[model samples]
Target chain A: MSRYLIQFAYDGGSFSGYQIQPNALTVQEELEKKLSILAQRKIEVVGSSRTDAGVHASQQFAHFDCPVPIQKDWVYRLNRMLPHALAVISIEQVADDFHARFDALSRTYHYWIVRKKTPLRRHDTYWFEAPLDLEAMNAACQILFQYIDFECFSKVKTDVFTFDCTIQKAIWTEEGDFLKFTIQANRFLRGMVRAIVGTLLEVGEGKLKPEDLHQIIQSKDRNQAGRAVPAHGLHLVEVKYK
Target chain B: MSRYLIQFAYDGGSFSGYQIQPNALTVQEELEKKLSILAQRKIEVVGSSRTDAGVHASQQFAHFDCPVPIQKDWVYRLNRMLPHALAVISIEQVADDFHARFDALSRTYHYWIVRKKTPLRRHDTYWFEAPLDLEAMNAACQILFQYIDFECFSKVKTDVFTFDCTIQKAIWTEEGDFLKFTIQANRFLRGMVRAIVGTLLEVGEGKLKPEDLHQIIQSKDRNQAGRAVPAHGLHLVEVKYK
Candidate 1:
């Protein structure tokens, strides 16, 4: 059997999520159905990450094994067969032992928030009517670097074993009228980035003190965290593997 | 009566166009309906330009007259009442003789073409799969500045009285994987920018010679031009009046 590593991108607006479910449309199911048809056999794809519904991905990696080698033009042919909102950008042969999800080293995410009200980008970016205090938000973001446990920000009843994650980079930048938060971590718990952004927004809005973030992290309670931000503003920017 | 000039923005994917059409939803109709409800009086808005269906506008201008003066806070209030995809950014009192379309001094347009295949921006930008000769396209763009008449690119059956428009700036810039064409002019005829982009793409693809653009403009026939590019890639960047 030959294993192939596929790099793809998708707009997750119309999908339930990346995982497959009965009676629900998903990115994985769509790709598998097409690949199976092309190969004239059943095929299953293993994704690097399971992004939530309405969350976009700029670069996502996956792996699939086939009994026969595929042509180089299969990448272009698969793209044409898929919907315009999903594309298979590249395909390459990989070692049979390489798995997309288990063999990843780190991942990065970006959350976009438009400070000024813009109708053109309303759907693509989250709109914050009130002015954000960038300095305060940045100060609070510094607290995240000191903590390795993020149980306060993780979603409840998640399948992951532990909430420990080493966050390498968490920085906010302002571009024109948009404020973006880019975070890189060894791994992320479900809904962690959104919860972090929500808490940072509270700091920006003066509802919570910057130092209070430390207390919230120590509390280890989901309720201590701020509300989760909308999914549309979140994007899986990159996935790294060694 | 007081005349007010409003700077607006909208995602044109959902509506038919900017103008009111029978049995079709439009940006004008939506705003008029909301204004009537708010003011308890019938209202009509005259937009700076009637954008075609599926064309987006980042900073469109419009004017409407009301019997009573409006407060500064009306900008935020109107935005709350408008749909999420449409917004009124600024409102200012204007002279009674001022008209949004006729009094405009200049208009700017931006066309986005993604060189790489990206699924996330499929609906937002045009995808050009083949490698583009951007330098050749820029060279062709420079030729556009020498011509004052663009009757060849204008849509047929257009009601404009004159076919002459001063091209102030026409340049193409490459940023990362995206190529953007920005043009500023005193006025534009219908389908003018799209036709220009289409012909330029033909030149970039080696399907048409760069010098043929000047010949096509001199022909002054719509049939002499290439196909009009899709409307989604076109954006009304700015409208200026002095």
Candidate 2:
């Protein structure tokens, strides 16, 4: 048997989510079904991140074991079989024990918001009409690196073992008519990035002071933080492996 | 009567075309229908450009005359009535003699092509996997400034009086994963820009030499030009008057 690692991208608009559901379409179900047909056997694949419905991904990784050796041109052939919204960019042979989810070093996400209505960016960006103070938003992001416990930003019903995470970088930038928030971390809990972006936007709106995030983190209370932003505006940009 | 000029943008994928047809949805039809409802009177609008189906616009203009004065906040209210694929950016009062199509000084268009498949940019860019020679394409564009007749590139059945168009600027540039061809002209024929881009790409693909364009233009024959590219990759970026 040979294990293969595949890097791909997907437009999450038409997908229910990354994981397979009983009667719904998903990224995993689509890939496994296509692979099974191509390989003449049942195939099960593992994904690195289970992104929420309507969340896009510029880069994602997956792993699957095949009973027979696959050719290098499988990447091109696989893309031809898949829908235009989902594409396989590259495929490579990996060690038999390599795991896509457990062996990742870090991940990065970007949340895009625009102040005005943009017909071109309606699906790709969150349209927030309120004026934002960029300086105040950046100030709140700086306080993120000081703490490790992020229970306040995570979903309460998640089954994760720990609420602690090491954030590598957090920054807010303005590009033309859009405001983007980018964050990288060793590991993230469910709904962490959206929750953090919503909280920082509150600071930009003058509802919460820049220093209030410190208290919110210390309280370890989910209600202490702001609301979670929408999923359509979030993008999984990178997945790193060692 | 008060003549108002409105600036807007649209994602042309959902629109059949810019002009009104018997049974098709169009940008002009949507605007006129909504404005007639808002004003409680029949409103007919004249557009700056008649963009083909699936052609986007970053900035476009239209003019309409009304008997009653409009409030300043109508810009916001009108946007609420329009679909998400179309938006009104600015509205201003103009002189009675002003015309959106005839009085324009120049118009600029951008054609985007990508060498690789990108899920995020699938709708906005044309993907062509062939290797392109940037230097050869730009050399052909420099020859555009010397000619005033482009009948070879215009649509065969167009009803325009003259095939003369002054080319102010033509340039090809590369950015990250995309190649952009930008052009400005005093006026353009029915399918001139797309035809020119198609021929330039032929130059880039080494199917045609840079010097071959001189003969193609001088031939005054539509059959001598290259194919007209797709409408989805074309964007009406700017229109200027005065």
Local distance difference test, each candidate: 0.89, 0.91
In DockQ terms, which candidate is top?
A: 1
Model 2 per-residue lDDT tens digits across residues B29-106: 999988888788999999999998999999999999988887788778878899989989998999998999988999
Q: Please, what are the lDDT tens digits per residue for candidate 2 over residues A122-147?
A: 87799898988989999998899999
Candidate 1 Cα errors over 4 Å, as ranges: none
In the order shown, the candidates' Cα RMSDs to the true structure are 1.9, 2.3
Docking class of 1: medium
lDDT by residue (B22-59, candidate 1, tens digit) is 99989999889887777678988999988888888989
User: Can you write out model 1's per-residue Cα lDDT over A1-242, one digit (the tens) per residue?
Assistant: 99999898888787888889899889999899988988999999999999988888888899999997798788888988888878888989899999999998899999999876776676568998786788989898889999999999999979988899999999899998899999999889999999999999999999999999999999999999999999989889899998
- Per-candidate TM equals 0.95, 0.93
Q: Quick one: RMSD of model 1?
A: 1.9
